[model samples]
Target: MNKKIAASLASIVALSTLAAACGTPADTGTKTGGDATQAPAQKVKLTVWHNYSGDDLRAKAVRGQIDKFKAAHPEVELDAQAIPPDGYRQRLKTVAAANEMPDVFFTNSGSMIKEFYDGGLIQSIMPLLNKQTEWKNNFTPGAFDPLSFNNEVYAVPVNASVTSLFFYNKTLFEQNGVKVPKTWDELLAAVKTFKDKGITPISLGNKAAWLAQSSILSSLANRVTGTDWFLKAVKQDGAKFTDPEFVQALGLMKGLADAGAFQQGFNSLDNTQMEQYFISGKAAMMIDGAWALTNMAATGTKEQLDQIDVTVLPSVPGGKGDPNTISGGAGGGFAVSKKPTGKQLDAALELIYTISGPDGMKAVAEANQIVNYKMDVDQSKVTSLFYKAYNLTKSVTFTPVYDAYLSSQGAEAINNGLQELLMGGKPEDIAKKLQDAQAKSIGK
Candidate 1:
């Protein structure tokens, strides 16, 4: 996440800052300011894509809003695709290389969105927001900062998120007579104890590559390298990934795998499979994002859900980071393709606002996810598991997610390198891979 998101997140710490419900943007085919969106008199077709493709509650909330938008605007024919996170980026890049971007698409903050903006791949949505003045005013101030570049807003964040947390089965921990770890040494002891009992100490699925980067290593690396040191390294400001502190962080992953912490073939398994391993009690712990809470709330049995509780990744020896913090916040969002105009721009603006606006934000909130909008919610409708995860954010600081802020090449190198590192690759070699990849951009 960016600085603006970090600043805005403090306002949402307890959900107590929330206001009464707000309204959605105006109807389709309406003109406001002179340069504002003007729907075409005839039918308009726009291509749309997003990463909320799984069957999880988070995905349903997003896709549900898209469905409503289609129904409400019959004059617009949307050719939409719901691609999984693993394949979504590459696909968008492929289309972009061919100069064939969709009319509107999903993207994250930091280097990912910056790449598109720098390449002239996206257009400013500021005029569209200016037209919907009331809707624009409702977002937590500074929520739009990450999506704005060169004083022009390009996208709107659908939600803010915490990308790392430890979800442990309380029943398993109690059954085994082991408590949650609060320090590196205690964590190692817990892993050894769980391993001795033939139970996987941690459930992990790294096949998609990102769980290794964003979920596992983001928080772990933060503990070892801290935010300031890491940002300097990211900017190549007298810092490199090959430094001993970052190397020590990479070693932690190797240390976990060597200690029999993760399940077999973790590099090949997907999140759905990992969730099954966790709920079945074969593994006592799972490390994932806040999004998992909603996915669990939707599909988990009440008994199963009740047995789970959330905790932060424990502190490291001589750690430079706070144990309570994790990598996440207002990052990924939606933007229109470069130079969209007339009917196409209108369709694109309406699509993003409808989903990221009041109705969409409320739908996301009801599914137990954090959002940028302020709306009163019925406490009874949200699951206890969600509150457990939600309230955990109150006491901690938030860190930048690795992928959210890293250059695409740097993100790629580490994501793949971590998989290799876990499979017995040397941490030094992997660290150098990132050092080289990032220098390509920052070095210049």
Candidate 2:
């Protein structure tokens, strides 16, 4: 893998060195430096929505950039809302049907943004990128691929996300005399050990259906199906989701549930709440993406933060995929509404640049998240558990993030099916559902 691919948001953006690069107190990126655009005449009222309400530096990083834009453009009336992650997509969809998407909003690439673009509710960001030549040049090439449609960039990538990480508390592991699991069976045994000790083995919240698929099943499934099988499955080529390999991958998730690895009522919980269960010692481990690392560093107490470390899912028997690969890719980003034009368009463009541009990427990088930008951070002062997490990403390969690869209908079918799996639904049933939905999606 290339250095940029190896350096995911996982731990490549080490918190301590980032702290040094960002200042000990952390550069909030809220500084209203200088205007990137001319001051607006009439108050440019732009309603913006995003899913950065997590209790982490990632959220602060997003808001800080928004605050900076607000500060610099005093004449612009910017109404920014930090919506909950679980609800933002549905809420945005509802508004989009009414042609009421926020002038600026956080949006994931692929089908999510494509829906908006197809409806003429979204606008391309390439024009502004073309103007800021240096800023455009800094991003890792293909960073904008997911958001591009027929070469028109509808959005910009905000994170280089490795969608799944097996985060464990070292203190909990030591206390229970359990070492990190290296194989699937060992992982199951560790779950039994923790559960017997009256601790939740894993903290999971599937209230948002996507978490089970994107954060857990994506990476876990990859270990069984392998990248080659997966590529065929997505394209409905030689393999299908219902094939034995993919079925086995789905069974592993069911296996975790059967082992009682997750906390009670996990499906009823939200992802943000799940972090607290692990952070506060109620759970021994949490399976999440890179965002959880940012949350732990930003909110957990220093001592508790020190106890946390991350790893990839354990190897499964007869698995076809590389044990070192995790499910992830560049996904989350922001897009503009087609409603804006003239000065409003200029202000909206500036807003997008401010949030995902060079300065903006640096802000998020320091906030404990990684971006597609090739940064100039000094790694010499790194001294935290965060650095270890970065090393993990550097060593592994990233599998496809399902949402970024699957058809919208196929992605939804699997996401909802995962929720069903946690509730004791059949693995083969879910696999068959996905296979049918995806095959029909591609007319294959």
Candidate 3:
């Protein structure tokens, strides 16, 4: 047995001995159904903080799952606090400093998991999973990989947000006499055609650096190299970000920007504005994730919705990457605090199981959010081009989008350097700055 289980058994033995000596009834029920005695009942009220603002319909649907959990587990009361997505990381850090983190919380699966692991604030979900076989088998293998720290599972993934093709206005494409591009050269040709027709070839929102980092640069990285190379580079396994391939990727992005491929004022545009431009037929294509489908369906007309299309990104000529390779992973997953007691911890695990399992997966997917579980859901329920994007993502092996896979500080450094590069900083200068920051923060 591991240290935690051994200690828990020892404690239970001592407690049972004490109760027997005091002539009191021994609570001899086993945790894993053996001769071991049960731990004493301790009612707990857990506080869970999530960055699920009311404006996000998907977040609201997740909140509804929490409510269902509350109804089912009446003994455990949860105080669900919803924070805005923009400042959630800061808020979580502030709470952690106060030693006031909630018993159960929602967090990004990858870098956030690593940060909390380093801080000793989160507990491994492996122990809990050992007791819940059904729950353990529900998640896809790669889905849970991000939440593992030092080979131990720490979180349960709620959704898989993967990057895939986001093509714009079929009406505009047909009007401009352009077909959906299937190869990198074809894509460039389409861009030229759109430019000649006085329409923007793409809509890119670079105001928030990660947006551009994920959709364009990261997509190019995955295309130029395979997933393993990118992952190894991010993990700093004898790889450098200043390689010719990396430089070449950045140069390609610069070339596209210089050719009037992206919409005017792209540097100032936010995601919502870019989405609006696409829906209004102002841009011919937009590269984004599956989540945009939920947003588009909420606002666009039925005709407008029907005109949208999804496909895998085109394979680059002479590139090492596959056309089907996508950038994506599990986004928000559940993690319990290390400080909670056995019963409370078990309760929290139960809640996670309730939300991320089969029924919950189908419901959330029906609401247009991509799920990471392996069970089959009704495909007809999802009525948007988004499902096609999601299917394409699943059809390919996922390379970690840099923003999701890097250490938090490393991600910030790379994002900042990329932002400067987009705003006219030299590629070599940006590369040097990124390397220096990585060395300083992550130690070679």
- Residue-wise lDDT of candidate 2 within 1-444, one digit each (tens)? 777656753363475346656556633334354764232233667888999886688788889999999999976899999998777888998998787788989898767887787788888888898999898888876778878888888888888877788889899999889999989999999999999999999999888788889888888888888888888888988989999888888888999999999998988988778988889989998889888778777768778877888888889888888888877767678888988898888999999899988888878877777677888544443226556676777788878888777887899899999999888999999999999999998898
Clashing pairs in 1: 108-332
In order, candidate lDDTs are 0.84, 0.83, 0.75
Global CA lDDT computed for model 2? 0.83
Off by over 4 Å in 3: 1-43
Using TM-score as the measure, which candidate wins?
Answer: 1
Q: Report the alpha-carbon TM-score of model 2 versus the true structure.
A: 0.85
- For model 1, what is the error of residue 130's alpha carbon versus the real structure, in angstroms, after optimal superposition? 2.6
Candidate number with the higher TM-score (1 or 3): 1
Clashes (backbone N, CA, C under 3 Å), per candidate, total: 1, 1, 0
Tens digits of per-residue lDDT for model 1, 59-166: 899999899899998989899899988888899899889999988899987778888998899999987789988887887656777788888888888877688888
TM match of model 3 to true structure:
0.84
Which 10 successive residues of model 1 have the least lDDT summed? 14-23
Q: What's the lDDT for residue 110 in model 1?
A: 73
Residue-level lDDT of model 3, residues 373-428, one tens digit each, is 87665667665675666666667776677777776676777777776776676777
